[model samples]
Target: MAGTDKQQDMLAEGPAIILVEPQLGENIGMVARAMANFGLGELRLVSPRDGWPNEKARAAASRADHVIDAAVMFDDTAGAIADLNFVYATTARPRDNFKPVRGPVEAAGELRTRFAAGQKTGILFGRERWGLTNEEVALADEIVTFPVNPAFASLNIAQAVLLMSYEWMKTGDQAVRPVESRPEPAAKQHVESLVAYLDRVLDERGYFRTEAKKPKMIENLRTLVTRPGFTVEELAVLRGVLTSLEKFSPRKPRGSGAPDAG
Candidate 1:
């Protein structure tokens, strides 16, 4: 779909995304697309290998014209992040330095706290092949690492940017929480109604045939029905099922349908 003027106005206000010596124009474009997906606006390129104004990158970015149009170029990593007050470097391997290491979620939370307090922040991503040098990782205040399979932890440049961006977006968004959208649990009356209906059906079917076990069986049946905490709709469905069985079944003994012995 074509981007609209209104959509362009909804630019994200968060950390910059810095690419240190990224190799491919296609990767740059995909990075732009990922940034756009998560509401990240600022994109800084530190000496991209394929050079600047790459048509391949622009074409690959697809509908994220705003990100491609506003991308800034820098000669080195230091130049790329010089303006930011806080910076994070993303690396899969543990560096020798004692810098604070955080997963993407924790890093995003820190970034959100800082950004909201009027501090500029950004994250540094390394090259496509060898990743950042020790010196580059040292430049950032903290390190961000992905919790991936140790045997194969390599991630593409765009994929890395997408992960960080998604987490950053989620930091301030309560919508991602499962409990936020969950329907309220069914009321006590609804559950009681279901339990009563079940008890009546089982009692008529001689489920509690033994006089001594009748009270215990009823209690167990009520416990089983109430344990699930069924919603109103679920209770209605259960009641409909019980009514159907009662309407269709013969009033004879439970084994009346069995074959007669010779």
Candidate 2:
């Protein structure tokens, strides 16, 4: 499903669960069920091999309606996590990349600290068969691995999600973290709308004429827009600017009477 509905119906202010290239709908459903079992709400899917809105996933989710209903899909790992300030990659094997490695309990503790400090956090789970690639793990700020028996390090996607979910729930509400008095960050949907609007305007002006460069340009725009915790007022102001630009004089040219060229 689209992410707009998920943004509106966000349940708990817990860390997001991002599934990258999940293979089976049943696994997706089970992951959602696990997240719901512990109060985790946001679930993001990055390029699931089997498309979304899967009946198998829904049936597997069973009574965990909230998690399944609010699940959102993305095209890539970077886009899936663009809105999150902090992310943890969950894996079983060791990689050559240089990153802070933490066990589940330690990572959970760190997540709590970050949450208390008002940061959007997420946990990245790789595919069911081979797990996360170095490139995907590199995207995360830290690597989270379980202390499993070396002989059998493979962990099911759903099982890994449940363990992290359980730890996230373990941090009791009593944790005294200062709540920010400022306005809550604008929802991802609203931010996306603003970006899309700007993109449309740019497109009409032939700003993306170079077909080969358009993707990178768009990526840069999205990154620039979503990196900040923009407030509602800020978003409104930006959209207003775009609207004004769109209506700006297209007839008059500079000193010479040359019509505005595309």
Question: Model 1, 139-213: lDDT tens per residue?
Answer: 576789999998988999999999999998898774233333333334444555666676666656655555565
Task: Indicate the TM-score of model 2.
Answer: 0.65
- Per-model TM-score versus the true fold: 0.63, 0.65
Whose TM-score is greatest here? 2
Q: Please give the CA lDDT of all the candidate structures.
A: 0.76, 0.77
Cα distance off (Å), candidate 1, residue 17: 0.2
On the 0 to 100 scale, the lDDT of residue 11 in model 2 is 66
Query: After superposing candidate 2, which stretches have Cα over 4 Å from the reference?
Result: 1-10, 173-262
Q: Residue 132 deviation, candidate 1, in Å?
A: 0.7
- Residues 130-223, candidate 2, lDDT per residue (tens digit)? 8887667766667899988899777899999999988887885546455566445555556667777866667666667565666556655655
Per-residue error (Å), model 2, residue 76: 0.3
lDDT of 2: 0.77
